[model samples]
Target: MDITDNLAAVRRKKLSRRAFNRTLLSAGVGMVATPLIGTRQVVAQETEQGTIFTWGGYDVGELYTSYEAANGALPNFAIFGGTEEALTKMRGGFTPDIAHPCNAGLKRWVDTGMFQPIDTSRLSNWGDVIPELVAMDGNDAGDGQPWLAPFDWGGTSITYRTDLFELEEEESWDMLWDKRYAGQLGSLASGGDAWWCGAIKAGVPFGEIATDEAFEKISAAMREQRPLIRVYTDDTTTLEQALSSGEMAAAMTWNSSAVALASEGIPVRFARPKEGALTWVCGLMVHKDAPNLDKAYEIIDSLLSVEAGKFMINDYGYGHSNAKSFDQFDAQTLVGLGLSKDPGDILSAGHFMIPQSQEWETRMNETFEMIKAGF
Candidate 1:
């Protein structure tokens, strides 16, 4: 079935929180079991090697070619819908050598005491990784060691069908809430991204987003825009399909969706919102009680290599953390993709979602859920 058909079919079934979280990060559609790479027998035998608990589609062998070449096998893989769920599972005795979490959740993850500091010296490519990403809000743990290794970076913006929506003004977040497009707009279902997008529309600066007044204003704006949305889903594939079929005039989406849609010959544009886009950086962390420490470091190093970075930018449409990765893509291609050779420039033009307390996160998510349900 096509992506739209798959989304329609999946919507008929009840989606669990875990499934929603996974789809949120990976930007994938449909419900499927956690993909276990390699065979069960191989996984069982490779238990001595490391296992990575991460977002779906990230376990691809190409991203870890070096590790596979050395060990003659791939690491066992597990999947989690979100960082909190993964942290909960780890606290309850589910151990994986490494886990992936974004900068917005790094503080909370570190507070859980589930991850140990990364020894950059052990990662051969560490020297070439972008310094700006290395210096992001939560990368450092206040000690000499760092907690998170910079990986994929990208923006969140409006993806619209150029053939459907004529821009009266420059592209802006207001497009998503325009009354003219009521019943034809879509948005991301998760607050992790949607809330920040709302903040941008509300003109609430990123640093002030946690204040009571900011919350009130942002909440009101989201509620006002709610009726205009035809669908609120975490599935980027579905969003792309809807745009391709002219089912949705505009939707909030990540950079990857725009690339995917355009590559398929869809006349779509990934907007550089007038208020600026929402940007983020996500990466890997080793478990505090990791069993295969050496292999875990190797896995991280491989992911930081230029080869892996090329795969990420060209295939996944994300900006890699390695500065050298930009060498593979020409200047025009980077500009067309809304990326800069230096990730800092892109981040500076946009607002980066910051870490929030678990309590605040809970309340924001709960409030967003109510708004989505028309409460």
Candidate 2:
């Protein structure tokens, strides 16, 4: 290496321990042992370099390992409970460099004109991304570009405590409303997940989910469950902890929550409801007025890396966009995790959320919020 670059690395090293790590990454070296400062916790904290507006669990260090290694610091993060809340905030003039929203909310996120198409060529790992995830319902930005860079994909199902929650029938959506578990049940506060699951329970078809009749049906179901729910939150940690401590017998949660609970030796199962689960793909979008545009691409690239995908799969039990991520696990292992080497195996079995209009989104969020407040 040139003396100029060597001198610069030394200078950066003197700045902070994190910067020293960045220097090593830049020089193509790796630390055999990560320092004790808690890298994942660092993500929950922040750095002023750039900002990633995402859901609660995504701010972990494991998912951003590549970014931290290359940039020396995890980006600043602004957490939102759901995509509806994130879009509402962004529409109200809060713009982060990057934002996360699921595939079902894609059309609404795009209609706002607050985000720009991501140029895949800029991401070094783009070629390795799963095509189906990249071509999510409305993600195309023309000429092979995409509005959102797909990151994680998975199902939203009931993660129930096996020992505490008794199953009378084939694991069904009715478990959440079994009446016996009243005040022992938990649910995600946002309509993004809860309302949809309510729809499944209400027997409202996804194709007709935007109709007025469908709204009434879904709302009624949500209201019925509200009195039964012990807590309503979008914090996966809250749900995980509740399941772990036996505070909640069952909760409507993502696959990751059950995975997290099981790793802690909690007897729990991510339920395969008889009514089918709510499946989704979530990705990152670059804000049209991003303050750190270059860094935004860098962070998105990091999320798409194999390292990030492995952590997502192994730690969080979410399917990653990188096709190569599944290579780390055998077919049987993936099956046990409620996943498959073929994305269609899991997705085709569950109901993919049908994209709705901004009007529907606004109505759903408002209605669900009211139900949650016991209105």
How far is each candidate from the true structure, as Cα RMSD in Å? 13.4, 12.5
Q: In candidate 1, what are the lDDT values of residues 147-197, reduced to their tens digit?
A: 999888999999999999978799999899899999889998889899989
lDDT of 2 by residue, 165-196 (tens): 98997899999988999989999887888888
The C-alpha stretches of model 2 lying farther than 4 A from their native spots are: 1-48
- What TM-score, to 2 decimals, does candidate 1 have? 0.86
My TM-score estimates for the predictions, one after another, are 0.86, 0.83
